[model samples]
Target: MNDISMRVRPGTATALIGRNGSGKSTLLSILAGLVRLSSGVLTTGRPGLTTGYAPEAFPALKLTAEDYLRGMGRIAGLCEAAGRSRVSELLATFGLDSFRSRKLAGFSKGMLQKVNLIQSLLIRPQLLLLDEPMSGLDLPAQHTLLDLLQELKREGTALVFSVHEPQIIEAMADDLYVLQEGQMLRTIHGAENLRSAPAVYIVYTELHPVAQQAVKAVPGVRTMQPAPDLSGISCTGLTVDQKMSDTCLQQILAAGGSIVSVKPLGGLGDLTEWMDPKDQIGSGRG
Candidate 1:
């Protein structure tokens, strides 16, 4: 990374956007203190500021999920009892309580990702850095994690994450940073400017099978899919026309469906096109 300067304030979310090998992950690592900066100065709001980092690829270990979390808590300076309690709480919150005793080596990609997040959250750090926090999660899991992060933001924790998902940037980002070849290409302060056109809105909902059919019958719902267990519908990419979005949402709510998130279709498009000179809106120095 070079000539990159940014600030993360309490209770705000910062998003890093870039193509592969553009140094997004490297920037996050530098913020997490995992990588040393060869030049430039780094400062924080307070000295010894606590920070947490969740990586994209989680390791598959022989240890059980519970053991792994507890070990992480201990490493974060929690006492034995506190570590055990925190482990149990996080496992239950992530709906992995039953799988606590299961070996991490046997866990699926989604499950391991949950463990990865749980470990980083062990200390309740003041600053959190996530390298693709939603990498391997399903819609429901992603919703749960988003809700948790929203709550953390409300509680005054600073969040900085690198992501390619437009939905995530729409839902969580307060500031957007576009990087190119280890340089700070542009910075957009508010995420609202990310939307190019309001043509389609992607709606996420959890509903019973009967409600699922009702939603499918909605006039403008273009696509949908069912949840893994068939307990509810998990729309892979439920694209609804902009004009019908409000009415469609109302009908889903009327049918007792829980709306997780509704985001515009093409808010952030292909990363390469972000450098277009004509697309400048909220671009500025950090």
Candidate 2:
């Protein structure tokens, strides 16, 4: 049930995207040499050709984030003097200076994400492969990472990474590969689909058990779901006949429940349909 073949040329930014368990991470690991390919050849230009890799799994043992990055720098073959300077510079750039001495065990998910990114960027490599590098970052942090990628691209570093968010793909990726069932289904020629808003929204609220009850009273709620971890609840397959989301938002706020986030159900336009849509024309989806 798995198959993929890609020619990753130098100086190109490629994105790998797919639903959960579709093998994005597995493909990345294969490329990183952390895992051996089952039946294919992966050849690189040189034995010493630098390649920076950041995988999701981290060491469980006690160690500061700084310690890990410093070690990576040394292992990548930078001399002691350069490794020391590079590690310090990367830690500060990724906003982990305050946590320099803090053990990785206590780092928040977001902090761990920053450290993951920092390690990959600490020393300039000929190729950079990131696996969901922006998973836990705030908006500002995401922007910072995008800027860093742009810098790398300008310097002729070939970059490939995986991301689920359309916004991330729209803003950062130069090309996209959509994968499913471990097979490469499509290589999108343009990035237009990423900029369009989802045709439908599923709103979730904070009141939980009560919120579920009230939403049922609302005529537009077509489906109800218990939130992950039972944090609250959500509604989906909204009744199309009414203006439900705005009304639902008001009702939830009045009931002392806050809107957690809106979920996008795809009706976003096709990536090929728009040579240019006015609303998305200048925002730079491509």
Candidate 3:
């Protein structure tokens, strides 16, 4: 992403958001120094910066979760005893204690995801970079990870995560950068003022005739549009009044359709406001 310039301050969380192939990953890799820029200056300390990265895909390895994390801690320059202690803490904190000796190959996607997250935290990074950090986790795992992130933020660790999860951004980020074609199209700040999108849910079930008819009767709900990835029948992407979300869920269950995703697209109201040219961030829209 060329011509993109932004600053992530200490003790703040920044979210880099954009559609697929909009250069979010590349930009993130560059910032993490995994990829080098052809030109332009990246100011850093003479000794180089430290970071923690959790990519979307877990690494291919046969090591057990505990062993792998301990190895990572040592690689991060921690002493053997310290590394082991840290590994124990991280594993227990993420609820991988029972699976401590289990090899990663035998682990489920969510379990592997937990390990992936653990390795990144081996170092108390000054800046943490997480790419789609919630991709392969269930609700409980996601909550655990987010809670850890919140704890880190309180300790003054700077965070920059690339995510499609608007909820994560609204709850954790101090600023959000919208990337388009490798450049930042807009920047939205003010976490306190940013309104979380009110409870948007995406239901994914085979549409039955009875269910379809019954869903239309749900107050404040319109027909769900197919999402871009064809991942599910999205009941989200539109405004959903918070009070009616529970009733809508009940109606979907009654209709015999199973749920695929119940996403809380927070910060959506902020996005809508940003979409308006009159909004402060909208003034810089491309």
Query: Best candidate, TM-score-wise?
Result: 1
Model 3 lDDT at residue 80: 96
- Across 28-140, the per-residue lDDT of candidate 2 in tens digits comes to 88888888877878888668778888886655437887777788778888788888898787777778787898998898888888888888887787889998877788888
Quantify all predictions' global Cα lDDT against the true fold: 0.80, 0.68, 0.74
> Which candidate gets the maximum lDDT versus the true structure?
1
True lDDT of residue 116, candidate 2? 82
lDDT per residue for candidate 3 within 1-286, as digits (tens), equals 5788888887899887776656677887887888888988887543657889887678657998888888888889999999999899888888889999988889988888888988889888888989878877888888888998998899988899887776787678898888765788878787864554355656556566676666656776644655443444434222355567778777777766666666655446535432222223322322
1-286, model 1: which lDDT tens digit per residue? 6899899999999998766666777888888888898999888969889999998778999999998888889889999999998889888988999999999999999999999999989988899999988878888889999998999999999999988687788889989898877898888786576644443554555667787777678786776754343245554346665667787788778977666667655345434364232323443321
RMSD of model 1, in Å?
15.1
Query: By how many angstroms RMSD does model 3 differ from the true structure?
Result: 13.4
lDDT of 3: 0.74
Descending-TM-score candidate ranking:
1, 3, 2
TM-score of each candidate? 0.70, 0.66, 0.69
Model 1, C-alpha of 280: deviation from truth (Å): 22
Off by over 4 Å in 1: 195-286
